[model samples]
Target: MAETKGLGYELIWKFDMPTTINHIMIMEDIQYGELIRKYKVEGKVNGEWRILTEGESVEHKRIQKFDKVEVRGIR
Candidate 1:
């Protein structure tokens, strides 16, 4: 996948039946790197990660410093 210009952290997401464990909810069939639905991401989640073919809407965040990312999620 193409790297985002300002991606704070690299997360390996997995998909399932939308599991909510420890207050963290993960949607079904939604895998980015190592996370679930609604994550703190920078840049556009398309072109690079083609999760949605057309008319796709991804949730990404524009972060400045990597330190802002409290958790690394995964390697």
Candidate 2:
């Protein structure tokens, strides 16, 4: 292979959220005081999610359908 060089990036991604949102909580008669709480489990990666691009937030990055991501749950 020829001399190829550049920087790569690594990250961890969590896809699935834990408990589904169910109810809304209302404060003492205050308008816009209704609070929505959703329970979510902290997802973790078994390994680093590596990207060839440099210094990029992987959000919305088009990974291959089968791209390897170490996640604790299904999205």
Candidate 3:
């Protein structure tokens, strides 16, 4: 996996090959206090986009799990 840091509001990752994923973890820098309130996770499965999961009130970190699915990309 690779990560690029920037001041953007979205992140998109495309794998070199299809991969099976079940969970994702997100973290926030809260030195100034919690700022994120809601978020969503989408996966590209079978060449289509699907909503995998969503949640609210993310203080420092969040871990979201869903049914295993083979995906080519995630955002």
Give TM-scores for every candidate, taking all chains together and pairing residue i with residue i. 0.18, 0.16, 0.86
**lDDT, residue 27, model 3:** 93
| Tens-place lDDT digits, model 3, residues 1-75 | 444333388788878889999999999999999888888888989899999999987788888889999988888
Q: Worst lDDT window (10 residues) for model 2?
A: 18-27
Error of 3 at 43 (Å): 0.2
Better of 1 and 3 by lDDT: 3
Using TM-score, rank the candidates from best to worst: 3, 1, 2
Error of 1 at 40 (Å): 6.7
RMSD in order of candidates: 15.9, 17.2, 2.1
lDDT of 2 at 36: 26
List ranges where model 3 is wrong by over 4 Å: 1-7
Residue range 1-75, candidate 1, lDDT tens digits: 222233363445432222222222223333554243344332223113322111222334222232222222221
lDDT for predicted candidate 2 compared with the true structure: 0.29
Off by over 4 Å in 1: 1-8, 23-75
Q: How many backbone clashes does candidate 3 have?
A: 0
